[model samples]
Target: MSKGNIGVTTENIFPIIKKFLYSDHEIFLRELVSNAVDASQKMKTLSSVGEFNGELGELKVSISIDEKAKTLTISDRGVGMTAEEIEKYINQIAFSGAEEFVDKYKDDANAIIGHFGLGFYSSFMVAKKVNIITQSHKDGAKAVKWTCDGSPEYTLEEVEKEDRGTDIVLHIDEENENFLQKAEITTLLNKYCKFLPVPVVFGNKTEWKDGKEEETAEENQINDVAPLWTRTPSELKDEDYNQFYKDLYPMSEDPIFNIHLNVDYPFNLTGVLYFPKIKNNVEVQKNKIQLYSNQVFITDSVENIVPEFLTLLHGVIDSPDIPLNVSRSYLQADGNVKKISNHITKKVADRLAEIFKADRADFEAKWDSLKLFIGYGMLTEEKFYDKAQKFSLFKNTDGKYFTFDEYKDIIKENQTDKDDQLVYLYTTNVEEQHSFIEAAKNKGYDVLVMDGQLDNHFVNHLEQKFEKSRFVRVDSDVAEKLIPKESTLESQLSAGDKDDLTSVFSAQVPNGDKMNFIVAFEAMGKDSSPAIITQQEFMRRMKEMSAMQGGGGMNFYGEMPDSYQLVVNENHPIVERILADKNEAVGKEADSLRSKIESLNGKRQELEKAKEGKKEEEIEQAQKDELADVDKKISELNTKKTEVLSKFSTDNKLVSQLIDLALLSNNMLKGEALTKFVKRSIDLI
Candidate 1:
């Protein structure tokens, strides 16, 4: 027997290990179990290379809990350390046995998990004392028992006869007594050791016998030794992938498609990424991708490991290149991690292109659910955008799908404007914008459905990527102007006539505080609606994006009132009749006021032009007084003219009906205004 204090620079290392070595105290189980797995794998490697000539029977890692004794033991059938090996590896705090074994057997070792010697010290986190009983595979080697409390001191001595391997017995501390519970240990094993290369046995498998649970002869193996990600893609069937998905997430819906990643040259990376049917909310879908290192589950929040948008995917990513001690800053700075992320982005984009090329109809069928992911990627990752453009699709309001180039080809002839810009018409709500969509379709122009959660941002991205192109919502302008192929129609109404018409229509618009109506005349032909409402494309997009982004710098647009163009088609018969009726009712009064206002405005303009080059003091006082009087008289006449128009508009129910019809079409007429419109509509009928 021999006794000694652990070799260290300081005596405070154990306290740091107990308090801050790992973020979660439960991580101790993962570290210990992983060590056991490494030992079992080393034994297999030695036998495979003929280093060990003994019977290599049933290599497994077994975990057991003694509740009354308040102890848990993890045993393995693998390479065990001799007494001298224990003094060097265990007593020297930071010395790692697995690291040495891996360096020596780099070619044949099966997934050695421990790179940091600190994994063994993690046991001190939950245990008051730990004992190791190990027997090396070398012939005539004496078995040894090593004991250590939660300190630097330890004891090593010869032990009773036993099979070659190791047994790590942890005496649970009073504060962490929960580690001795069967259910608690079972859950920890399932989470951390569920996919270890060696089979992990917890206890005897149980079955119902005579309506009661009873232990069976078979041992309960908790892990799948060979997970789907570890195997070659050629060996897997669709059913096998699906079953693995179910095993990973029992309650989640089936995935739309999957990408199997396997690469070895620059850095080894292998895993399966599944494109799940993401919900409308991008936030709830994140943290679903589990990250692993050599089949050992590391974390679920892989935001640092993958690009931000790829967090929407679900499944597993295992890479030995990614270290177990993952800090956000480390992952961000690591060169290998960046390569892995870039590789994943390329793999996803290539897989999508392949699927689209293999079966376009099937791809189209799944586009509705797939666009959110693709759109998010395109908006956030430039590399992904470059690759995704080949497979990305545009869905029309007619339930038809087309690639970006294909849609451009279809619309180039008919939808290109006089400025040589291809206009991509789109609608957010099919039912609400039905009229606008129909108007566009009637003119042989196709409209896309840009209604996804990220469509607003994605449209902006596409504009930057697609040269000489723009996306215009169907309702952003009148059908005739949406994709202008010729010069705009000239309105025949005089400036004075337009002013009178503006007052008539603007007087009936609802909720001046929340909505602003800009009355304008457009010659949209006699077949068009007499009055149509449209919003400007730029302002509308800014406001939509502001709302989506929760209103940052673009909040200025969101805070402004909604401005709509109450476009009255000058060629429509109803508008012609309304103009005629307004002239008949208020023409005499309006004409007299306009003549007085025009004469006064001429005198005022002459005075303003005369004083243009002169300083304010140089201008004569009498001239200023006279100019002020002319402006006041002109303002009075304009007020009187506005009153006459207002009275005419109030008396004419046709004007109200036209304005309400425009509002109703835009889905903006709601609450009390909608109620009043319903009543007035019946009265007019």
Candidate 2:
């Protein structure tokens, strides 16, 4: 036996490894098993090159846990290290300066072990002592045994070993006794080695018999040597990919489609990405895309490797180009990783385009499920947006799908307003906004179903992308005003009459802290409802986007009360009769107050026009005071006119009934107000 200190500059290497690497000590199994796989693969390479004459038997890695002994052992049938090789690879942890090495690497423990050929030493993190017994494949080579007790000291000796492989025994520390359990070992092996290139064996297979699980003689292999991603895309069928998706996510719903990624030139990348049927929430479905390095699971959070939008996809991505152990900044800055990301984005876009061009019916059939993902990509990535626009579809309320250009061409001639701006009418809820949708259809206009969770932001994006185009919710404005082909019909009511009408309807609008209603008149023809509720498009969209984005910048808009325009249709018979009744009820008092208000307004208008181009001192203080007094009188007269109108309007059941009908159509009437409307309906009948 020959014993010497392990070639480490620092005496406290063991403690440093334990202290700093405790966060990721669980990956110790992956490192060990990966090393075993590397050895097995190297043996195959040597045999292929005629370097080794021996027959290469079954290559496998096995893990065993002894609870009583508090030891976990990993054995591999691969090229084992001899004494001299062990001295060079395992013992010598070369560093230029002891103190400097500790200072720099003490913080980045994972980087030190993963990138510095210190994989074997990572065993010290969980084990109190580690022993290696090995026999090299080289002819006449002596078997060796090496031992280290979590210190700089180690022992090396010639040993008797029957097998031409290696056995690593880890005496699990007191704090890490969990590793010395069969169930724990199996779980770790399944997680890190489930898709490893080498077959990994845990223990004997079990069968349920005699009311208990009984171990069988057959060894339980825990890994698949060849996973689906390693296969050729041509060999894979649609069901094959679907089955693989099920294997990856057993509980998730079936994905709409998948994109197989296989690139070779700039960097090696092979994986399958599935467009899962994501619900309204995108954040809940993230971290499902598992990233692998040479079939070994590295991480599920591939945000640094893939674009933020692509992270919503599910499945596996294996690329050897990305370093397994490096700083996040370094991984992000890697040229090959950037190329891989760009390639993936390109591949996804091309695949969607191909599907859209070849089998548009099928693509449209899946559009409801596919739109959320595409819209998300367009919103987040500019490059993806540039590509996605070709295939991104606009689904109309009539269940028809069209590309941006196709829809634009179809609506360009008719949907263009007086300003030559194309208007896109959309409905968030077909059922809730059914009346509004019907009103739009009656106007010979197409309305899109922009009801997706991301559609709020997507419409804003489309507004920026499509020249001279704007998206208007079907319920956001009266149909005639939504896409104004010509100037809208003006209300025939005088200013005083309009104010009285506004006061009449506005007083009956249901009270709520979350919403505000403004009374206005629209000539929507006699066929339209007496009253219709319409929210302003810009403010409504801002509120919607603020709710989705939840950003501080837009929170004010989100928190502000929702305001809607309560448009009274002037052409409707009910509104005409209501005005006639008001004119008879108020008699001549309204006319007298209106004439006096008009006289004051006429004087104030002249003073405002005279003062516009003049210096501030040129206007007397008395003139300014008179203007203020005139405005105050006008407001008081308007208030008196409203009081007269309210007395007549409030008593009229038809006024409240008309307002209730609009509220009911908007799905805003509820509780006592809805109950009162129902009771009022029965009484009227």
> Against the true structure, what is each candidate's TM-score?
0.95, 0.92
Residue 630 C-alpha lDDT in model 1: 93
Candidate number with greatest lDDT: 1
lDDT of each: 0.88, 0.83
lDDT of 1 by residue, 265-317 (tens): 79999999999988778999898888888888888989888999999999999
- Model 1 has how many clashing residue pairs? 0
Q: Give the per-residue lDDT of model 2 (tens digit) for 64-103.
A: 9888888888899887988988887788873222223334
Best by TM-score: 1
The global Cα lDDT (0 to 1) of model 1 is 0.88
Off by over 4 Å in 1: 208-214, 326-332
Which residue pairs does candidate 2 place in steric collision?
none
Superposed model 2: Cα runs more than 4 Å off? 94-115, 326-332, 488-490, 599-636
Name the weakest run of 10 consecutive residues (lDDT summed) in model 2: 107-116
